[model samples]
Target chain A: MSQFSDPDATGPMAQGVAIFGEFVENAQGVTATVAVIGKKNEPLYLRLFDEYQTKELYFQSLVFVSLDVIDECVERKAMQQDMYLGFLCPIDEYQIYGYMTNSMIKFVVVLADVHRLQDFELRDFFQKVHAAYVEYLLNPFAPLDGDKIKSARFDAAIERHVATILERPPPAPGPGAKA
Target chain B: MSASANARLGEQIWQKMPKINAEFFTLTYGAMVVQLMRDLEDVQLVNEKLEKMGHSIGCRLIDEFLAKSGINNCNEFAETADVIAKVAFKMFLGVSVEVASWNDEKTSCSLLVYDNPLTDFVELPPNINLYYSNVLCGVIRGALEMVQLRVECYFVRDTLRGDDVNEIRLELKEHIKDEMAEEYRRE
Candidate 1:
């Protein structure tokens, strides 16, 4: 059981957070947190992957705090068909990004400020996460009423894909990489 | 009618039907099932409620099916079964079913559903007795009843339960005949 108040911590994310913090010190572009929010702005799934495992509450609160910015983005660009909402606000040492599906489900990812990612890389990450989320929704047992996601398969999928994205070598040191 | 004829008819009807996104349909059904599970709490009750709901839909669907397909009536049980497996299932679900395992009396048979839209992305947890697609049995029963063919329908095998394929066993119980008042009867 996680010391934090995550609705369900039996997923693989909890395990990764618990045992994988040793390498987080040198972790660049590491995903600090991932969240899935329902249409009613309820947290459907949340995971904290920060190096400091004790900061789960802080990272969780950061995800909830971005909901307002995501809503504003949605309202401002209601006519746009793009699902990626791009960079939201940055707090303390983490940068938050947001994405919303056609059905109004929201995904938010927080990354440590060690490295800033390219816009296209962020879009790709969001698209992949969206696909996983759609697949998760297809599970007949998954709750649709904003309850927390508790499937180990879904957790594993997210963790696996995020690992692949993070494993990419840093971009070539061109003029564009100076940012 | 031959099996090929039914298949062709099914294909024609499927092509003409107004279609929604497959993902949307799948997610909606998934969401409904989850909601049912939460509300009912009991797995058996949720299964029953889904079947009941399907029964209502099936009752209304038969009329539209007849009107759209322009099919009059099947003369024999074999023909009806073929139509259901090849035509009805194809047109509505966009998947084909195989009719197999007929009893000697011709009163019972099984429908082999290989690719079920309802069971896509579904992984049942261990030790749970929930029938995820039980509603399909009710739909077939209610639809056949509307055509005056009383039948008993149920799941014999489910892919969700680790079966190779989803099999629905359908048994003919009764064939309702025309019984009208003297004044209403045709001369």
Candidate 2:
């Protein structure tokens, strides 16, 4: 029941990253790499840096940080109905998947490698992980590592996820606690 | 909720008139607050200036809200909340109003944004605790309170994805709608 177990609980971008990281960890058996990028460009995997490498990137270091989306939407003057909920994740060979939220915020879980595992199960796993990442974000303490994880927010997020896994509803009183 | 009332409510008088677009108003409001912050050099001055500005907006906006909604007087806090959410915010910002649950003595509400022009590219400096696009809440509170309803307005959540939704919670202690008229009678 580790707190970070729920990947979907993390905010949208973080959730996308965590889902990709978890998928890579479970399938490729590697720790997810993190980097701090700015809003100048979309979220993409840094090919220069390995997955586990930690780095301190400035606000302007990597183009396309979080604020870029807000800026793009603003600049375009997109209408209210056109609002989108999705994640920008780069997988390989300059290919990135922007996972938008379903009505329930579940990722559609498309597969890049069909031969690796049960395609259906893997998709479900991805959706679960996405949901957990979103829950992790609700903790308010989760690290918003645009590039690398350095703050207490990330750890706190992990801790909260573990708690959610162990949490259960209280039992209904049979006779009367009030009496 | 009456049929005729709802029918009357749908009309946007401002929409037809050559009024400022919502984006322009929101951007100008945000820039004005930002400028005040830079010039005042004190939190009190900043707060006072924002209240004053909101008050001016409220005085004009209230009349428009009432006129559009066909609600000349709100007898209860619930009705007032409804008018503000349905009429005032929608007319001005093209967003819906949502009354949120309270965590404490402070009540809360949200001006739901399908699109917010003010927050465009608005990267809040990492040092600031929260953005102040919610100065509208203060304006509403100050104006309504002057009219007699004591409201504590604050942001509960910002609807902006990634960023929090701008929430303006109005906690009402008593029904002061009658007080406005009572004061007028005294005068």
Candidate 3:
């Protein structure tokens, strides 16, 4: 049994659940997730990768954080199509690429510290996602329609592709530089 | 070059390049469309994502196509279409598409795909708005766009969607000059 799951564990409890890892900003300092909001305008499911997985609580909040940007986009009547929202600098450079299909399945990719990705590169990254999603759907063992993806193959793909864009720690606060 | 030499080129490229089982390719594409329907539950949306995904694949793979073929710059759009049908299709899918039915001035042409490798053993059910082989459209549009040829490529008919023959139409929109090429890169 995991200690996080134990009922006796005492730290801070939210709705009878104990919180082991606080929602962290840099849980996986660099992370990505595929978020799906259902027809009811409710958050249906999210497929998170890397340290984002560890800091599930924090990342969950970030989903809403990302959605706030979407609401802002709609309100501003901005050409939010194929737009990336930039936030959270000084601590880390974060860019969120949000693309919504005509059917309203929102595809969003969040990047940290790396800004060199070209439009085509980002497109290729999304293709990998499309490929992975297709792969999961074809499996007979997997459920046909569900909120969560249970395929290990898809998980590995998420980890593998997300690593390609992760930036190295900003030179480790080197000498004569702001620590 | 003689027809036999061109055939040899196709064969040589096929033998040299790495290949995967055709079923895997078919399933990957099939599943992509299936997931689109299963998730989004909208036909127009599925078509949009399918082509978008294919466009993404096309942009990346065109670079590989150019490097591996080591062919010279195309002198005309005629040769470009031929290379795509014969060389690119043969090298990747192990089959060549039939390029025919050119319009006046040869600015437009239709390529009839007799056997679409992406739809092998797959059938689309009735009452569903699905473009099963949409990735092909994206591949053509993307690959052509890279070479500064602004051509509109779409499937006039798809056998997977119960059309009599698989037909892809290509119409030249404009010749994008090198100076203004970057504008076309994103769109």
TM-score of chain A for each candidate? 0.75, 0.28, 0.55
Residues B46-152, candidate 2: write the lDDT tens digits. 76667667767776666666555566656656566666666666566655556555445443444444455555424343344444555576668755765567777
* lDDT of candidate 1 over A1-179, digit per residue (tens): 22246466654455545534644554542355788888888778877654445555556667877999998999999999999999999976679999999899999999878656888988998898888787777787765677788765567666755665566433333321111
Give the per-residue lDDT digits (tens) of candidate 3, residues A30-146. Answer: 355555543333554556655334444433444556666666665574555643333322222446665444445554666544455676676766667656655655543344443
Once superposed on the true structure, which residue ranges of model 1 sit more than 4 Å away at CA?
Answer: A1-119, A134-141, A144-146, A163-179, B18-41, B72-76, B118-128, B159-164, B174-187
DockQ winner: 1
lDDT of 2 by residue, A1-179 (tens): 11222344434345445445444544432212222222333332221112342321211122233234434534454444322323333333121122233322212221223223333433443444445454443323233443322223233333233223324232232321110
* TM-score attained by chain A of model 2: 0.28
Q: For candidate 1 chain B, which ten residues in a row score worst on lDDT?
A: B178-187
| Docking quality tier of model 1 | acceptable
Clashing pairs in 1: none
lDDT of 1 at B129: 81
lDDT of each: 0.80, 0.44, 0.63
What's the TM-score of every candidate structure?
A: 0.63, 0.44, 0.49
Q: lDDT, candidate 3, residue A49?
A: 55
TM-score of 2: 0.44
